[model samples]
Target: MSQPELSEDELLQRAGRGDARAFDQLYDRLAPRLFGLLRQMLYDEKEAEEVLQEGFVQLWERAPSFDPERSKAFTWAVMLFRHKAIDRMRMLGRRNRLVDGAVLEQTTLGGSSQAADEALQDAERGEAVRQALNELPKEQRQLIECAFLKGLTHHVIAESFGMPLGTVKTNIRRGLLRLRDLLKGGA
Candidate 1:
């Protein structure tokens, strides 16, 4: 009889133990699905491809810490990829913000009073967002700040705060939902 194929969890476990063949098999099995996910998250083929490659490198380094009792290999891999994608998004956002600030400064210098008025409006909107975030419960607010403003991954936030992963995710989600509602109502 032919031998059965190894399960993803089993393959991951073997990879954790430094089995090169098992790692290759795991990559073959998971890369396509992960690439699809990255494409959807990044909305740019090149960025997705880069993240997929980086995420696999990270996965290899971290796999020895994978705990099957805590979660499946695929779920663990998904989290790693998602974190990488989010980091990429955050980096892009920061770059865009810097470019926008420069543009705003140049416009204010060259344009009429209308540009100044727009900048003032932007400041007011920022204050409103700050106030809205302040209205959240402390736990939710802290988690949100850590994840977004600090650009920390969910796993890092959970570990640093000594909270369960589920709790961290839940708080961030609920906080964002409440912040959205507050913004909409304010607007």
Candidate 2:
């Protein structure tokens, strides 16, 4: 006799790309098996609930990266859910490693934009630059703000702010120096 075949991965992939029906199919395919496995592994109902739900959420979030070549869909979810539950077991040591590895991977993939919408979604890259304005001192930021936002003449700003034009110039230069450091630190 032959076992029936299932398109578990195709459904999960569609779900990962935001199809509601695919998500439902994935839930139908995996939820019962997961609940059973968790029941055998965990004694406390609350612990099982937390671990199972967390595992499910990670499945949804990271589903886009799941590769059928690596493992069967059911086995992958089971392994992930088990590791998630077990992580709560003794996390102090291994938690840091897991977080660090994830951070490293995200760093490498940070610049990948699948669409123009995704790239423009930040739309506030300017505000991000403004926040990084920590690169400049208050005086410099004020000067740049006055010069750029108000369209004030540099000489006029120097006179209104009670400073010589050259000092204003000096602050703008040094402030830009600090901002470079701030943005680098963020990355």
Candidate 3:
């Protein structure tokens, strides 16, 4: 007799109990959609693939904690993958910023006089932004970092930080307004 196709919840339950085949089945069923989502978010095939792999690893480890009452298995999986993609994007952004800063520093220190002048202006703008960020309260700064630097949605930030969704949204709005005022005032 042929085996019946398992529902996602069934597969999840089996996988949660350490059934490798069930986990593989779940991957086979969900990988394409998850990959597509990650690709759209990350805009790089290699990074999407990496995030997908990491997501699966996380799913395997956290499967036992999956709460059907809270969300469907597929939804949970997607959330995990999305979070992983965002994290990878943030890491890449930070790395690129660091590399760019180093190159800018080198050019400023050794390049022609005109290029050095441009780099100095860039440095001053960067310093001003840094000072503005420092002036924010810690919570507001964190909200701004999550929204802008990490490219996370307010809902994701709220969920990850265990804050109310409205609170997250309000903080981001207020933070941006404050940052705008600070920049306008040349603080």
Candidate 4:
């Protein structure tokens, strides 16, 4: 019989242990979805492509620290890429002010108006995610808030909050699973 397909969580765990094949598999599964998200967030194809590349490099560097017990591989990756894309947006915003008038004119002339439609959809989805997060039990919601909203890692959260590492990881895992379910049902 053929080997069973490994879950993304399992693959990520293996990748953390230096399994190149597992890393490749994880990349194949996640890149398209992540790229699409970057496109929506950035609304610039070249910037999205650059952020995607940079995000993957960061992922590989950070893989060894990943704990499947805390969060699913895809969600962890999405957070990483989202942060990268946000940083790119901030940098672009700063640079746009320094550009010549010709550059501004060129961008407005070439830019897609579809970004407005995507922004509306993104806002709706963000509201749904916020509602779902609010529905979580207090402990889970707080832990998730620390992790995602504050951008703290499990270790840092544990240290900062005086909780055991395992407790922090468990709460995050449960909260993320619940949040995923809530988003899917509401979406």
Clash count for each candidate, listed in order shown: 0, 2, 0, 0
Per-candidate alpha-carbon RMSD to the true structure: 14.4, 21.2, 12.8, 19.1
Give the least accurate 10-residue stretch of model 3, judged by summed lDDT: 95-104
lDDT of candidate 4 over 130-155, digit per residue (tens): 66765787679778877876678999
Q: How do the residues 75-177 of candidate 3 rate in per-residue lDDT, one tens digit apiece?
A: 9998888889889888767745754575576666775675656777766766666667757776897788788767799889999999999999998899888
Q: Ten-residue segment with the worst summed lDDT in candidate 1?
A: 95-104
Ranking by TM-score: 3, 1, 4, 2
List where candidate 1 sits over 4 angstroms from the true fold.
111-187
Whole-model Cα lDDT of every candidate shown, in order: 0.85, 0.70, 0.83, 0.81
Candidate number with greatest lDDT: 1
Which candidate would rank higher by lDDT, 1 or 2?
1
Which residue ranges in model 4 land beyond 4 Å of their true spot? 100-187
lDDT of 2 by residue, 34-136 (tens): 8777767766455576677788889888788879899878878888899987776654234334434444454446666445554444434444455565235
**Evaluation by TM-score, superior candidate among 3 and 4:** 3
TM-score of each: 0.59, 0.44, 0.60, 0.53
TM-score for model 1?
A: 0.59
Query: What TM-score does prediction 3 earn?
Result: 0.60
Ranking of models by lDDT: 1, 3, 4, 2
Which lDDT value does model 4 have at 30?
96
